[model samples]
Target: MPVLHSAIHKIDKKPDGTPAVLFLGGAEQVESQARDDLMHQFNESYNGTAGKGWGFFHAESGAFPLSGWLGKYLAGVGDFLKFSTIAVEHLVRLMEESNLTTGGHALFCHYQQGLTEYLIIALVQETEAVTMTEELSLLTIKRLDLDHIRLAARINLSEWKGNPQSKQYISYIKGKQGRRINEYFRDFIGSQEGIDGPSETRTLLKAFSDFVESEDLPEESAREKTHALVSYSMAQAKLGEPITLDELSGLIDEDRPKSFYDFIKAKDYGLSETLPPDKKTLNKFRRFTGRAEGLSISFEAHLLGDKIKFNPADGTLTMRGLPTQLTEQLKRATA
Candidate 1:
């Protein structure tokens, strides 16, 4: 529960006469002491209101709403700050009063003004190890490492200075990377009047790529789930490792396109996944010219001694066992 909820309720007669609090929850001794302390603090306040914001004339202050303390947003002298709406209201007032810059430039200036630059880090905390390629870079590796990245990520996830939502934000961080990235979200989004650019959210994963290149996915399986899996896996893949079949299956839908011939031709040459025949596994490979047009490449082994092998019959790539001279021509052209 938030500090705001600490207040007890009661019914009252009023000028405007609206619905009123009918009763108060039973208060413990500690709460009573806290209430008295708040009252004393309010009496000692500079404004004598013990409250933030401009609404009250002379607040007999005893713990104002969290929104009240959001008035001053001096995050640092030269820093971009993500603030709550109340803080932004103060900013709008300041911007309106200033005559120095245009709106676009002013906002940009505010964003770039932060003292230290930060990064948002996200790690698949509970996810299994996955195959992946190069990690994305914001700056040169010469300038940072995993520790630096993690620390920068932490700063990004920080939340409201005096609100309970900040605790919720903290709970989202399961480990170092997740927490770091969470920080980035808090600082970057909390203070903004807008969203970040498309490039900011861009990510890549090899397991997903391998999955798309795999032979199992159905022709009409949902693609959205595949996209999300790829995104999540990419963040967790081991850099410089070849994606495994099992790993690939987990990250993308097993969508084999409807047309078998087109699927084979497209996936064989396009994806570079080796197609071999097997009784148990799904058969999706094709050869343009062969004894078994739709047969798996592994089955071609049984017929190897009798005629032209499927591997050598790879249309125009190899210059042998072809009715036409297309492969010969390509060889000649390259030569």
Candidate 2:
């Protein structure tokens, strides 16, 4: 539960005048929570929700890291997680926008990184032991029978990293490059390999079987743009909402996948790629609602900045007495 943050703290007043964040830390720190709530209140005295929270802050660099509620990724133990880079980005952005991010990160744990699972599985094929279904199942009262295919499917379809790899499993997670095991998985396991037979179940089965037959895997790729894939996968798993096509496309930065193969998989029940007819843009009405509260505060701040006198009746802001030239300059600046 310990959080890491850069050493610098304190927001200094800037001569140019945009508000700079001071006193940075993980946003979940109770004291930081209180402070952000106060800022949200000023930003929205009329709006509700009590200004719950914001993304956590990094002190020295001032970067706000997304909160980690997605369960810890399990590594070395199994294959899964590494496939969900897009989902992870979306998760962080959603948390930041909603002001719900709490700021924690996974060094590693419980779920597998999907993108890399296959190659590692292939590499380890010769070994005496495998991370078989019996070892990783999180079965409940409702389900019976061991499920390796679906388990692998979910991890591959989900996020990119989990943790605690032993010497045997370290390479995939070596530098946190999600693309590694993932590319091969896509190239080898989850790729659109030809499937035989009718049932979607049959297709999945064929895919799994075909994967076990691929070539010896290569080295893992180096990562770019440090990602928050684990965070997103956890959010999507928890929310359980079907994503819109646009949202899905946005999530991966990739052009939408050419075929319906991902959607065709049987294990992905309740998942959706259909987009709303009127694609969601911004919600400006929500913006106007919050502006109602601090409109006066903003006006007052504006007044203080100028040596101005105001008449109660006129809606216009004016300085009662000033030299014409200076008044004109102030009016221009205000405008």
Candidate 3:
């Protein structure tokens, strides 16, 4: 939920500058249902049992026990799966075309499975420009099972401090760096070690499986810190005051000696590398001003500048000067 919110909240005109979403569903069912209805209408012509009642000729005659419903349901489900696959392929193609993106895009799915079952899938990609040349993309895959409950897995596809986006079609930083889309899905559904993927991938898959089995586990990752930053910003914007870096970390129970930003960069998002984020990584994203006595540091998003200023002395941030677009969002949120 947090990921989805961060991906699409208050953002308009996705990086593609278009609809960014390709929806496919129920296109053929209209025609098929029409044909079935017409046939049933004609069958109704049988007036009495002396001849053959409509029930005698077709499965539609028995509404409860249904005749052709099984076949129809299966066909419909097949079409849904087919379209969802196509949508993913299209999304990947779009990502390959644009080297950089500035918004978010996603594919949502919910299709019938059986008489009482349904399948749901959502693939999301949220992008934001961190600087002139660098961007951050959060990629997520979610699904709902027979219980109609949703579970998800996410990968931050952003490049490391010195790294750049790959020119190829499929790259997932730590895991599946150059693997294909299908390969990613296969590895996700199958075995983790089969693809030799990143630990984050394994963790997410385990989390998803555990959720389905009602064996959920606690998850702690550098990515959680990214979401924490977003959460902290939203809170600060609402309170109209800056909270100290230590206060922010304490609120989230992130007791690590190194900053969250630095830890994330060091881990490379749990890709192949493992390191804590440092001042260098922090400075790359923002201007980190450290306090000697308090041993606290404050940061300002260089891109946002004065709109979101930080005071290291009191360890509070004042967003009164935030950009017009973001201030408007804050107003809408608080309203």
Candidate 4:
């Protein structure tokens, strides 16, 4: 009840656009005072303990010994490892729910920057645990470890002026082997297909990736849903009518192109009068387009203007992007 009451209080708004005061249980004066005191104490205790080894722990004051704070933080790798494990679990769940599999040489990555670094750490740990699976280098290991890498960067930029050991670690990362590792990180993070890629494909991939993360759905469930959609699209393509956005939106189901175009241009609550979609809705459309495009490319399907058309009346989509070779393959698969 306390948690629920707390949530209600956070959500409740007054008519004057201010937060509404919520009394715990009732309007009892003694209970309300106690509750307020308890919340204040809890917040203070949490703040005191939260960033013990981080610079923010003493941010209220004028303390700015970043290296000192960061050094203390580096001593607590075990605590960080536990939290990273939980984060990785959630990230994997998200990937699975998005119908994404981490295979191949790890192409088509769509990880958040933090997760990208965390994965590097996990890989470094795995390499250390095994015996000579490949040639090993200390600089490579450190580069993959964000804390070590950041410490080096800070020291190089003359920001880390703390412990002598921190200086030594940076010196090591700048050594012969370390230079290569540093270059690798720079390329990986900066490339178009990497964590900070600037390509539209990357953006679409990230949008789909985020959708799964936010939904927190299971991989098998997402796979099933996508499989149904692909089958529907393939069937429509085979019938020579294909599926249009209107048909996809339940406007019409007739096996004809004109029917789809007509349904969309019907005017009343149809495509002609539809407003622009919100960002979220637009992203959904983009994701669908990307997925279909990926499938088409894989199947050697045609996707020129001749095959896929867009009607200006309602911005409706009509697609037959699957290639003839893929169509035959799909028929064989179904048979």
Candidate 5:
């Protein structure tokens, strides 16, 4: 990663209805190996985190307009330090208004990976821990709690600039369900949810299933393709990247590179060219297949506990609601 600029500022606040304090860093470029490592680790954690929302920035207005400030910085009107200072001040104000108690060191990094540029903003907290020194003596230290990143957002500068009409250029961690505590952080960035990750993932899986059935692929071939799909999606999720349909199609079958892509296009599944994979939904997706001397069975893993029951000891499966065609065939044969 090539870091164009990076800085860290501190915000001191408590949920006890008190004023928040802001500590700004100097306006000098802070580039170091430690910074690189921190950015890399942060990217890994952010990529692995689930339940992120994707959207574009809100209109640039109000007391602390983030998009306007970012525009000035990007247009060469001010240095990154100036930009971050204004942004953190806005965050402090918003935190106060939201009555949020949590505060930490806010890190702003502008970096380039491959041909794409990105801006990552995260609020990191520190935890105290005991460690051993070179002499084997115990020592107390403060370390960044990267494992529990709550408030963070990354902007795809390349996409935002190149694709002016795109809505998923910004991705952010959206706390747990039924909680709006992180809404303030999103408002600070001026982003609204534009893409439903889970729904999109489900659609993709459904399209893949339809493609498999249409192809009339053997059980082994179907299983292999399913694995390919999941593996590619998970890898993209791990890299904080979206799954490109054409690219995924190529990966799924090199022999017929455009087979899946063409299938999806013909079916009109309403999928975007690229999709943000939902890890949770992907984790729940599985296909179970079995073939014996003269029997064949296949079903989605999710239906096991509901529509289908299995007995491991007896090596038997009890399925409800057989296909209408199969039911008619059995009825005719018995009659």
Candidate 6:
């Protein structure tokens, strides 16, 4: 990772709605091993965090002017330190307006990973810890709480510059459902939700299922394909990368590399070329298949507890609310 520029500022505020104070960093950070390590750790945590939403920046205007300031910095109109100061000032104003008094260290990092450039903005807090000295004396210290990163956003500079019309170039922690806690932070960055992670993942799975059904593959072949999909998706998630449809299709079947991709395109699933996989949905996605003497059964793993139940002691499977088509066929056969 090559860090172009980095800075950390401080926001002092209390939870009792006290006035906020902004302390801006005087200069951009110099390249160092510690800086590199911090960026790496932050990336790992951000990637592993769930409930992140992807979107593009809102229009650069008075209300959401961070992008304009960033544009000036990127265009060589001002130094990074100046730009970060202005940005943090805007954050302070938003925090005050939102009645959000919680404050911490705000980190801004501009770095390059591989051929792509990214800008990461995060608010990190510190936790106290006890450590023993070389003489065995106990000492207390404060360390960054990287494990519990709640307020952060990463902008894909490469994508935003290359594809101005793209809507999913910005990814940020959106907090859990029914909570608008991160709304102000999002407004500070001027981003809106463009893609629903869980919904998109579900759609991708549905498209995969349709492709399998259309191909009429054998049980073993289907199982292999399923494993290939899950493994590739999980690996991408671990690396903090999105699943590329074409690349995944090739991995699924080397002989017919474009088969799946073409199927998805023809069906119009409305999936982007690359999709951020939702780990929770992927974990719940699995196929339970069983075949015995003239008996075959298959269903999704998520349906096990709701529609299907298995008894380990009795070695039996019981299914409720059978499909209407199957029930109608059974009734006709009995009649």
Runs off by more than 4 Å, candidate 5:
321-335
Off by over 4 Å in 3: 1-157, 160-162, 165-181, 184-335
Clashing pairs in 3: 174-271, 242-316, 242-317, 262-277, 262-278, 263-277, 266-275, 307-321, 307-322
**TM-scores vs. true structure, each candidate:** 0.20, 0.16, 0.16, 0.17, 0.93, 0.95
Worst 10 residues of 5 by lDDT: 175-184
User: RMSD, each candidate, Å?
Assistant: 24.0, 26.5, 25.5, 26.4, 2.1, 1.7
lDDT per residue for candidate 2 within 31-101, as digits (tens), equals: 35543433233222211111111111122211222112222213233122332232233333433443331
lDDT of 4 by residue, 7-79 (tens): 1011122335342332222211233655444333432332222101111112221222323323443455433
Best model per TM-score: 6
Better of 4 and 5 by TM-score: 5
Model 2: lowest-lDDT 10 consecutive positions: 279-288
* Per-residue lDDT of candidate 3, residues 1-335 (tens digit): 01111111111225544643434333323334443432232222211101000001121323122113223434564444354444344444444444323223232322221222222222333333333323565544432111211112212112111232321111111222234543333232221221221233333223222222231112333234434544553343232122234454444345643443343344344332321112222232422333455443333345344556558899666655445876899799999
Give the better candidate number (3 or 4) by lDDT: 3
Select the stronger candidate by TM-score from 3 and 6: 6
| Error of model 4, residue 166, in angstroms | 21
| lDDT to native, each model | 0.26, 0.25, 0.31, 0.28, 0.89, 0.88
* Candidate 1 lDDT, 201-231, residue by residue in tens: 1211222333333544332342454444444
